[model samples]
Target: MEIIEWWPKIDPTAKEWLVTHNGEAVAPDVLTKIVAAGGSLTSDAWWIGEEGPDGFYLSDEAIDWIEATANGEKA
Candidate 1:
């Protein structure tokens, strides 16, 4: 699924956490939801990737999507 399509399906808390954390590793539960929604956890090209000890991080695309969502854009 597209990130925009799955963005809303994520828990509200997860959204808040991700937005607040920005470039940091996402919470495990949130990461699970993202993966289940078909998000890429291995492709740095998408800006989302799994770093060995650092965990999962969102790229500019994810961040931009969140920001647009927050601004009331409909995925």
Candidate 2:
């Protein structure tokens, strides 16, 4: 599913973290929420910029999407 479709279903903490951290690596708990909300880390390039022992980084597209969404715009 598109991030927009499932964005509202993610936990408030996760949403806040995303907004606050922006380009930082996404925490595991927040990643869990994204998966639970129908987002994919591996299946789509839109979700991940890089992944390794460090953690997941949101793609530029994903970051922009979140920013736009947080700003009350249709991403």
Give per-residue CA lDDT, model 2, range 39-73, as digits (tens): 87767645568886788888889899989988989
Model 1 RMSD to the real structure?
Answer: 2.8
Instruction: Give me the runs in candidate 1 sitting further than 4 Å from their true place.
Output: 40-47, 50-52, 73-75
Using lDDT, give the best candidate's number: 2
The TM-scores of all predictions, comma-separated, are 0.68, 0.83
Q: What clash count goes with each model? A: 1, 0
Candidate 2 matches the true fold with a TM-score of 0.83
